[model samples]
Target: MKTKLTRRLLCGLIAAPALLWAGVQAHAADIKERTLRFAFVQPKESHMGYGAQKFADLVAQKSGKKMQVKLYPNGTLGGDLQTVSALQGGTIDLTTMPPGLLVGLKKEFGAFDLPFLFNDFAEADAVLDGPVGKQFMERLPNGLVGLAYWDHGFRNVSNNRRPIAKAEDFEGLKLRALQAPLMIDTFKALGANAVPMAFTELYAALESRAVDGQDNPIVAFATNRFDEVQKHLSTTRHVYNPLMVMASRKAWDSLSADERKVLMDAANEARIEQRRVSREMEAKALAEIRKKGVLVTEVSPQERERMREKVKPVTDKYVKEIGEDVVSSFHAEIDKVRTAR
Candidate 1:
């Protein structure tokens, strides 16, 4: 009986090693070796670049180095609009941009572009990580797959003309605006001649005096070296831009389930660190810009409120276009965050 029991134990140990080897092979087979292109408008030192790099590292670790993400920064692949089109056509694999850019594909996305919608990063994060944000992602047009939401930070105005200290200061000033209807309309309602332009061409436009001013996050103003051309920086905080990380549907469909899971996991994990880096950079960038001789101005609460009230008609018009249900759900998410605080 002892001899028989020893033989059975030896057989069980031999089978265990074979079973573990087979499981390892199966896991490896679930991820294929491939390189994906990730393109964005920001330089390698910006938040977008930081997030993209973090995501690439996570994907490589998770996939055991079988998959790679190659980044194209500083609009090397093209402007945001061009990149989105390339993604839908499967010529590009990944990109991140403001949801406002998708307003043409789904008008509901316009709700995100509303001026003065979020009070701070906390309110923005709660709303974005909540259900309404999920609905927006799930309802993306057929050619795109939304992976995660990342920070772009709040936008402020910088110009060569004068500081936008009040709603009246916006009168008759020419400003470069994103090529989104709501964005253009919002600036127009604020009394500026809003020129719709691609981001890639904006620096030259500012330098050539084609537009008097433009609004972007402080990091952009600093990193893009807008201080070299523009002399005034105003803390408008007019709109908070949240970047939507997206993958091409064609490329995504080609990925194995394991590969897809790795990409999504990497994107989300990178989001936390990306936001922290972004918020931290804002103050530092502002100080750097000030050191470069750019005059900084602050918009008072009363003036900001007046600016918001001035754009109410534009907001109301878009709310109807964006669907009342969607807007209400968006507001409810924000309200929940505010009340909880």
Candidate 2:
């Protein structure tokens, strides 16, 4: 009986290795060797690049080096609009951009551009990761596949003219705005002469004095060297930009189920690290911008409220355009997060 028990234990141990090997072989069979291109407008050191690289690394590791994601940063492939077009045309595999930019493709996306819509990162994350965000992605056009929402930080104003301490300070100041109607209207409502322009063309526009100011997250201001050209920075935090990681539907349709799963898993995993790096870099970037001699000013809570009031009409106009049901649901999600806190 002792010899029989010993023999059974030995046989079980011997079969374990074969079972593990078979499982590995099955997983490998579901994947294929493929390469994907990811392009964005930010530099390689920005949060966008950091997230892209992290996702790429994860894909390679998960696929046993059978997949590769090559990154193209610094608008080398073109600006956000052009990149989106490329993705739809199946010329590019992946890209990330503010959801506000997709207003042209889906009017509901304009809800994201409403000024003061989000009070903090926590609220924004809750909405974007919740049902509202999932529904928005599901409504995307046939050419795009929404993967995940990544961080782009809250936007603030920087100008060569003067600090934006009050809503009145925006009057007559020529500010470069994202090429989205809602964004232009938001700036216009605050009394600025909003000049719609692509981000890749913004630095030259500022240097040439074509636009007196621009608004972006502090990390963007520092990483893009905007402090070198702009003299003042204000913490308006008017808009919190959440970048959407998207893939070409054409490219997505060609992938195996295992490959798609790998991409989705990697994108979500990278999102956690990307948001952490973005928030962490913001303080350091603001300090560096100040050290570079840009006057940094914080808008008082009262003043921020006043600014929100000034943009109320613009928000109302867009809420109508974005559909009341959608807007109400969006605010409901935000309220749910606020109440939970």
Candidate 3:
């Protein structure tokens, strides 16, 4: 009887883990297995791609490998406009794009395109992760959901011509601008002949001297090797670009509450990682670009102010376009951040 009892006890112990595993799987039965597509315009090794992969890993882990996220980087799917349309149409599951690219969907997003709006990451983080940011997210289109905001660093000018020391330096220079009304207006207001174009075509355009200059974060300016084609880089810091992580409302609606929680949590976590890496990369790229013999010009405080004043009218036009209440709320949020500091 003792020998028989021992055998039964051992068997029970061996079966215990299997029973627990079965229960856990049963509990997660509502999470259907899926293969989702995530697309972004940056290269696979960029901060954007890193964030996407982080989110994908988190989803897979939390969902017990039920959800597989396939990544399409380097604009493999399409440009930002096309990606946004695909997300809205449910052809794509996720994307991370600059807010300026989203103006067509919600003009209020143009608020982010305002020159010199954010002094640094602290101010930006305070506004974007707080109430004002939530307001923008809530107003996103019916078929799209804003997940989180990641840093795209500050926009600076890179040119094949002379360095921009003041607002006047922008005069008559043809600059390739993002395909957004606010961006075009902002550059035009600063006296540059802003040529709106897709990012994918920017390199060849620069090589062909189709545009005299362009503005982007240092990381992009260097990583895209714009330094090779351009001779000067000015630290204008005109716009603080933020990457908006978005999800398709159709894909979001199809998920169970638990699945949604996993995705949301993962996005927030990945945001932290993405911003940290972006800052590091920006610093490294700046050093690399300088080593390449590019004439790096640092715009003085007075010149920065002059440039800001030049574009003040552009801001005024967009405030009305973006709605008074939204702009007011944004200012109120900024005020809170300043006071807290």
Candidate 4:
């Protein structure tokens, strides 16, 4: 009788934990079935908005309808600052934004956006796909996990004034820049007197002559219709912009292991698809911008060299401020790129 009682007690102890575990999974599943909201500033027509939607769709599919993401585009949720603020405070679950805005939260992120740091998408991809991106992602906490960096392509100067073949032309022009600190400093250093503006406000600012010009990739200019108001496009390729896709830490913690795996897998898949779309559309966007009456200017190699020389000090100062180790890692990644190839 005593042996039978001991055996019965052992069985109940083992079964109790399994029953509790099953109960937790069911609870988590219920929580996961609710909506997830993502925010970005661009319109749904733009690739930035569409790419984010693609990510949402992937998450929904992979999670077997366990999650659904609702997108807030065109500043419906808020501008970049507000969106990031929400993400940090757990008021927003996800955001696809340029890394520039997050620098206040992680100053080392600024290192990724330093003027003229990357020559093109290939080099940018290599660096972002490697250690530089890895470190930047790990540097943030607020439940921020940088799943991948989407290319914003190279930024060029667009103006209603004459073509800019030299740096002197930038003097006194009211240029519109993304509220990026380095971009503000870089344009100021060039004597352009830039006004930082949100994307939603840019067209009106350009149309009313509140700002004389703005900068973005040719593809973005054409697709987003910035080329319509702006009369000139100079291939300055000033900064290599990358979109950071992040999720809220608070929301992420409540998820099960299976749910986490599904979300991450979907993000990885969306990145691969987004890269292909970016490349396929780039040349076509450039052609379309030219067709839209935007006079495109190509600075000669010597002229580009002179511009780089001018911005070199701007780059050096940021490195000093960020840290020696960060600067070293950045240079090592850049050293891997070559123009001749």
Per-candidate Cα RMSD to the true structure, in Å, reads 8.4, 7.0, 7.0, 11.5
Q: What does candidate 3's lDDT look like per residue over 210-311, in tens digits?
A: 999899998878777888799999999999998989999999999988778778888899899989999999898889999999999999989999889999
Clash list (residue pairs), candidate 1? none
Which of 2 and 3 is ahead in lDDT?
A: 2
Stretches of model 2 off by over 4 angstroms after superposition: 1-27
Task: Tell me model 1's lDDT, rounded to 2 decimals.
Answer: 0.91
lDDT of 2 by residue, 74-178 (tens): 999999999999999999999998989989988999988889999999889989999999998898876999999999999999999998999999999999999
Clashing pairs in model 3, backbone N/Cα/C closer than 3 A: none
lDDT of 4 at 252: 77
The lDDT of each candidate is 0.91, 0.92, 0.88, 0.78
Q: Give the better candidate number (3 or 4) by lDDT.
A: 3
The top-ranked prediction according to lDDT is 2
Please provide TM-scores, in order, for all candidate models, with all chains considered together: 0.92, 0.92, 0.90, 0.87
- Clash statistics: count for each candidate: 0, 0, 0, 1
Query: Clashing pairs in model 4?
Result: 143-249
lDDT of 4 by residue, 1-341 (tens): 99999999999999888766654654556336768888888777666766787888877766656678898888887888888788877888888877877777767777767887776677888777897888788887566766777766778899988888877778888899878777788888888988998787888898899999998876678777887688888888878788888888877777777777766777778887887787667788878877777798997767776787787878888777777798678667767776336
Candidate 1's C-alpha runs over 4 A off are 1-29
What TM-score, to 2 decimals, does candidate 1 have?
Answer: 0.92
